[model samples]
Target: MSNVSVCFSWQIFTMESCVLIILVAMPGVWGGAWGVTFGDLCALKGTSVVMNCSYDYPSGYSVTNVGWSRPHYAAASGKWRLFFLSRLPTPPVHFEYVGDYNGNCNLKIHDVQRTDEGNYYFSFVTTLDRYTSTTPARLSVKELTAIVRPSTVAEGDDVSLTCVLGCPARTAVVWFRDGQRVLKPVFQARREDAGRYYCAVLGQETVRSASVVLNVQYAPKNVTLSVSPPRGVVQGSSVAFACASDANPPVTPTAYSLYKDGQFVSAGQSHTVLGVQPSHSGLYRCQAWNNVSWRGVDLMNSTEIRLDVQYGPTYISVSLEPQHAVEGSRVNLTCSAVANPAADNYTWWHKRTDSASSSPGPMLWAGSGRVLTLPAVEASHAGLYVCRARNSVGEMSSAEMLLTMSRGKRGSQPHLIIAGVGGFLSVTLVIALLWYRKQRTHAERKPAVFGSGLGVRGSSSPATGDQLDAVYANVGTSQWSPPLATAAQDAASRSQRSARHEHELPTSDEAEVTYSTVTIQPRNPSFPPRTNNSRAPQKCGIQCLTLMAVDIHGRKRDTLV
Candidate 1:
C-alpha cells in the first residue's frame, strides 16, 4: 500500500507538469488532461451544437459524478452565480451528455437559441477529489442581418450594402437579391436593381437576413393614352381619355396634359368630352411628368391616338350623266353625300311630268344602290328624279332634278318642223288633182245638138253611076233622084242656113256647145260610098265621117258614124 501511494503521487506530479506546458502553448483555453477541444464556438440560431470533451485522473481514482455548468448573473447578489446540470437518470430534451465515465465527455445542445449564448464549464467527481476546468467554452449564437447605406436612391446613383452578424467576428459573407446570388455589394443603382435583398454566411446558406426593398427613382417611361369605349364613337356622345405611365414616384393627377393635333386642349390625368362632334375628331396624345428627369427633359409624351367621330349623311346631292338624254340611250343617276362611315343604302324616286297630266305625279320607287342605271332609256323615263342616301345613323334626300327625253337626236327640232310642213303640202296637192279630174269627166258625158241638112252629087262616069246606085241602096228606102241643078241649089242653101243657126243652137245639157256642118262629095266623082246590099263596094267614096262638138272650156269630143 505504501508503494502504490508513492506511484500515484508521482503520476499526479507528472500530469500537472504536462498541463502547465499545454496552457502556455494555447492561451485562454482549457489545457489540463481533462478539457474541451475548442476554447470558443459560434453557431447560427435554431442550429444544434456539439462540444467535444475528455477527462483523466490518477490511476487509483474512481469517477462518481460528471456534469456541466454555466455562469448566470444574480441580480439580488450583484454577482455571477454558477448553475449546474447533471445527467442524473437522463439528460434534458434540449441537452444530452453522450460521453461515458471512462474518457469521452461530449455534450450536445439541440435547437440552439439566442439565449444559449454564454460560457460553459465541465466538471467531474472522483473518489479522491472533485475537479473543474479553469477555462470555459464560450458559445456565440448569431443571426444574419443586411445593412444598406441608403435604402432609396435615384437611378445612376451609387449604392452600398453590407452583411452584419449579431456578434462581431471575422467570417466570409455572401449576398443575395430575390433569391439570386450577387457578386458585389456595391453598385450604381438602376431600375433593375430595385428589389428585396438579404445576406448569409459563406458556408451557411440556410442563414439569411430579412428582406429589404430598394427603391429606384426614375423618369416616366412607356407612357400611353387609353380611350374609354374604345370604338364606335358617335356624334353627341361622351368620350373619355386617360393617361398612364411607368414611374417610381407615380405622376400626380395634375401632372398630365392632353393635346389634340399638336394643340394643347386640357390638363388632367383623364379628360372628358361631352357632346362630341365630327370636328372633335383628330389625333390625341397625353404628356406625363414627375419630379424625376432623364438627360435634360422631364416631360414624356405618349403615342398619338386617333379619335374618329361618326355622323349621318349630309349635303346630299344627285348627279346625272348625259344631261340631255335621248330615246334608246343609257342614263345614270349617281347619289352622293358627305358622311362618316359612308352611306350604305341609296334609293331613287321618280315623279312623272307630261302634257296630259297637269300636276306632278306621286313618287315612285325607281331603283336602289349608289347609281340608278337606265339600260335603255325611253320617252316614258322622262320625269323629275330624286335620290335618298342612308346609313346606320340617318337618311337624307337630294333636291329634285329633271330628267327629259329629247326628240330624235339632239338639235333636230328645226328639221322636224320642216318635214311636217313638206308633208302637209304633198297632201294638199293630191286632193286638188282628184277634184280637177272629176269635174272634167262630168263635162265630157254631156251631148250637144245642132240642125241638119243633106246634099247629093252625081258623076258622069260609069263608076259614079254604080256609086249612086250603092248610095241609094245604103239609104234602104227608095231610089229617088232629083235634077243636078235642083240638088246643088238646095244643098248650097242648106249649108248657109246651118252656119247662121249654128251660133244660136242650144244643147239639152246645160253646157255650151259648138255645132259644125260638113258637106260630103266624092273625092273624085268616080269614087262612091259603098252600100252593104250591093255586096259592099270594094272601096267607099269617103274613108271616114267625123263630127266634132266644142264646149266653152275648150274641151272637145268627136263622133263617128
Candidate 2:
C-alpha cells in the first residue's frame, strides 16, 4: 500500500442496532486490509468507466461510524488513502469528497482516472440491538469501468453506440453529453444521431464511458451535368457544361472535358465548340468530375456537328476585241476569262485551217500557240488564233480570230519615171519631121511639065554652011546658061568657077549661042528611065523651079528670046 492506515476492531458493532457515535480508527500496529477488488477500469478519452466496492457491518452499530477511503498503493505505512468516502452528519474529515453513506454508498467519479486504482477501506458502526458495534472496513479501489462505442455510422441512418463494458460486475451505465447527465433507454442512448458521445455509471468509486467516432457516408443520387447552349453548338463556336450533384459539397473544382474528331479539346466547363468551316465538323463528348470519388464520368454520351462553307464562282474570262488580224499589223490579242475567283493563267490555241481535208490542221503561226501577233507580214502568218484561260475552279477559252495579209508588190519606181520622159521626147521629134515633108511637097509642079524649059538660042542664019565658018566666027562666045543653078552652086562651093558647059564642039552653035544645039529627047525610051523606084515617089520630082530673064537696063528691048 502507498498510504497511512488506521485499524479498528469489529467486535463491538451489532448488526441491528445503531447509534450516532463516533469511532475513529487509531494508529494501529497492523494496517487495515486494502485490496483491489475490481481490476483497473478502462475507457476511451471522451467516455466513462466504473469500479465496484462493498462492505458488511454487524447490527446495533452506530451508522455514523462508517468511513470509506481510497488510498494510494504507493504509500508507506501499508494502507490506501481515502480519496472518496461516505458518512452521516459530522463524518470523518477524509470523507469530504467521497460518496454519501445514507443508503447505498456507491462511488461514481465522472470521467474516471487511471491512477484511481488503489485500496479502499470502510470503517463504520451500525445500530441494531443498542450496543456499540465497531467494525473494520476493507476496500479495494480500482480504475474506472469503461466501454468502447462503435466507431462508425452511415449518413441518414440510425446510429448505435456498441458500448463494450470492462469490469462488468462493477460497471453501470449512465449517459452523459457535454458533462451533463442525459437520460436514455436502459443501456442505449440514441437520438436520431450524434457526432461524439459518452456513457457513465456510478459504482464502487469511479464513473467512465466509451468514446467513439460516428462517421457517415452517403452518395448524391440523380447526379447530372448541365450543358449550356445544349443544342449541339455550331462549329468554331463555344459551349459550356457544369457537373452538378446533390452532394455535401457542390463547389468542388471538377473537370469537364470535351472530345471531337478523335481529339480532346477541353477538360473543364462542359461545352465544346466546333466553329464555322467544313473541316471543323465532327462528333463530340464530355467527361466531368466533382465532389465524388469515382473516376471521370461522361456528362454527354454523344453529339454531332456539321459545318458548311459557302463560296462563289471561279475561272473568269474577258472577251478580246478585234477578231481579225493582218499579218503585217500587230494584233491586240487580249484573252480574258473572268469569274468570281480570278483566272490565274492563259493559253492560246489556233483554229485549224485546211478546209479541203475537212480536218483542222495547224498553220505555222497557229502552231506557235502564243498570243496571236505578227510583227511583220509573211505567208506563214495567215491562221486563226484562240486564247484559253483557266483558274482553280474551271477553264474557258475565247473565240478564234482569222489573220489575213496582202504580200507587197516588187518594182523599181525610179525606172518607170526615166522611161516616161524618153517617150515624150521621141514623139516631139516625129511631129517636126512630118511638117517639113509637107512643106517640100507644096513647092513642086505638075507631071505635064516634067523636063521642059531648056534654054533656047537663035542666031541670024548666015548662008547655010557657006557662011558657017564666018557665022561661027562672027558669033563669038555668046554663051547659053542652062537651068543648073543648084548644080552650079554645088561646084561654086568648092571654088569660084565659071558656070559654062565644055565649048569644044559648040564652035558653030556655041558661037551662035543657040539653045537648039542642046540635044532634045528622042522620046527618051532608051534611057532606062533613071531606074524607077518602087516606093511611093515624091510628087515634086523637080523641086523649086526657077526661070531666067534678060534684064535690058531701061532701054528698048532687044529680042534675045
lDDT of each: 0.71, 0.39
Per-residue CA lDDT of candidate 1, range 41-116, in tens? 7776755678777777656666777778777666788887555644222236777888888767888887677788
Q: Write the per-residue lDDT of candidate 2 for residues 40-142, one digit (tens) a residue.
A: 3343333333334444444333345444544443346566333323422222432233434433343444433344344444444334211111222332233
Estimate the TM-score of every prediction: 0.58, 0.26
Off by over 4 Å in 1: 1-43, 46-59, 70-111, 119-121, 128-138, 166-169, 321-331, 353-359, 373-383, 402-561
Give each model's clash number. Answer: 0, 75
Runs with alpha carbons beyond 4 Å of true place in candidate 2: 1-63, 72-105, 108-119, 125-163, 166-256, 259-264, 268-285, 289-561
Q: For model 2, what is the alpha-carbon lDDT of residue 420?
A: 78
RMSD, model 1, all Cα superposed? Answer: 16.6
lDDT of 1: 0.71
